[model samples]
Target chain A: MLKAFASYMTYEFIGLDQGSRIGDVLNFFIYDTIKIFLLLTVIIHAVSIIRSYFPPEKTRKILAHKREFIGNILAALLGVVTPFCSCSAVPLFIGFVEAGVPLGVTFSFLISSPMVNEVAVVLLWGLFGWKIAAIYMVTGLLVAVLAGFVIGKLKLEKWVEEYVYQIKTGQGQQVLTQTFRQRLQYARWNTADILKRIWLYVVLAIGLGGFIHGYVPQDFLVRYAGNGNPFAVPMAVALGVPLYSNAAGVIPIVYALMEKGLNTGTVLAFMMAVTALSLPEMIILRKVLKIPLLIVFAGIMTVTITAVGYLFNAIL
Target chain B: MEIKVLGPGCANCHTMEQLAKTAVAALGIEARVEKISDIQEIMKYTMSTPGLVVNGKLKHAGKPLPSIEKVKAMIKEEA
Candidate 1:
């Protein structure tokens, strides 16, 4: 009787050990969340400081003289460095228009600013490595330039608010009075402010990501998102539209989804969609643009990026 | 050193103020922290807020106050 009881006890202990080990593996995801959040915070703050030195007014002048194809290239390059957020869009737009920057060139800057922010670049690099980061940067720039050229050709000048054109043309050349020291001070403050607003979003998204990292049923996500699924890319893009998050906040989730066996193309499409088509940004845009223009902009971005995402996944 | 939390008195702004106080206390720093709620005044230094100004230099903006270590580093760098 004693020998039988001993054997039973050993079996139960082994089972519990295996279960607890799995639990430990799951718990590691929490640490990953913390690490990612802290890293992103630092990177974003650094970018914010850089953006402070080059005010939007300065960018306006650069785009003005270089209008057309060259201007589009310059604007895309600037877009890679500038860290403008959704709120800055209208003011920047007005500034560019006031400076007589060609519509397509200015549009390129606007599209690139929010879609490929510094924080997104840093986060993508951290999550996926330099190759994916480079791909995103190149692909993102192409979309902005192409979209701007197309819209410019369409002659969307009538869409501009009259007040925007009347608001003192060439305000870009006005010398900012703030001292170098003061500018640095402003940059630091902006960095912290942006970080505070988005930190919660980052944490919430990462927490969801952590949970996904731990226990997403891989077979299910894969069956839908995986290879040769004709609808997968568009479906992913559509799914991403309503959701709003900065790239810094979404890349971790993307990584988690990928780990769960989601296709790279689908994940990329989702990332671009969420960043570019945020509902909050759309609501904000409504204050500035007519509904038709807003829909067209969003629709173009969604279709273009979905195609890019699929192409990337198939190629690499 | 004087620390100011600049914002439009939103919920997040208030939370930032409290967090700044807590972080300052945690570090046992001898500093006066004030919340600047006026939009006009906040715009004087930054278009983005809640801005964190330590010793008249903006330490952070568009984000909450950082952890205790960051605060201490700012103090050290400024000092």
Candidate 2:
């Protein structure tokens, strides 16, 4: 139905020439926009309902004092369903510390939450397919886990700000309880909230993708950032670091880049780097962690993301 | 009565603070709605920012902030 509507609008209503590149691009954009928004509405609402059940307080209780590897893994998983905002990073970090959750485990949660989100997943699935979405998610989680484990082994607790250890989260955390109706209400608002924030990015992504599909010549970027270039992955990560956008904002750019003949691994790495590591988040984290730890975090993420890009480039 | 808004001074935190004040004034209640900007102080209430504390009891915390009506209800409950 979506496909038919997209084609009708492109070919009949707009009267773009049939079988032309512009028609194809328009169809792709229209079909993808509708499919992605619908998927996001359903998935984000469901995720919000799940999130209402597992607030940060409950996640803290579940993760505190667990073994290292297992804790890191659990923390990364919880990061996905837990609704965390960058603004709350300081308190949440301290809360984790106060709960006896290891610094590394906390890092895992912090890394995965922002990078692997429902909007990104929905967009990837709608545009690329499930396999690519699955790859993005699994690699994202793996990167978080591996980086957290490495941070754990480094024993960088001393690098944390002195005050983080001293501050005690209140024991009387009021458990936020709501009725099913309230949860549904929250979900409705949550979906609208997410859509409002990312609508521009989605539109821009699809628009840019359409432009690329219609105008940019095939293999345009292949020579420079293609699989043949050994430095492509690192270069992509380097370019991605300072640039900041949410996953939704970045994926369309990824699609455009991939379409222009950027190899899969290099494009994926660029997306990960853009979403996973950003200067603003680092600045926010600076309140809890010292400069050195932040540096180490950035370094490890860059390396891991680059490696993943290369791995996928070679295997897939 | 005391109402405290806890956050590290983000946009949401400010909105929460403003909501508490409006809720207080609309209720015609003589209450102080304090904005707690200090992270240490904020943590003593809840891990999530934009936290609402009614008489030092955490009423709500985190994003997707409660509506103005809900904020009024919380204050009324404390009142």
Best by DockQ: 2
lDDT of 1 by residue, A43-151 (tens): 6656655665565656776788675877887888788666455654545565567667888798788778778777677666655667777888888887788777777
Q: Tell how far residue A273 is off in model 2, in angstroms.
A: 1.0
Which 10 successive residues of model 1 chain A have the least lDDT summed? A168-177
Error of 1 at A157 (Å): 1.2
Q: What DockQ would candidate 1 receive versus the native complex? A: 0.09
Q: Which residue pairs of candidate 2 clash?
A: none
TM-score of each: 0.69, 0.96
**What's the C-alpha lDDT at position A66 in model 2?**
88
Q: Pick the candidate with the highest TM-score.
A: 2
Per-model RMSD to reference: 9.0, 1.5
Off by over 4 Å in 1: A1-27, A30-38, A169-188, A201-211, A249-252, B1-79
lDDT of each: 0.67, 0.89
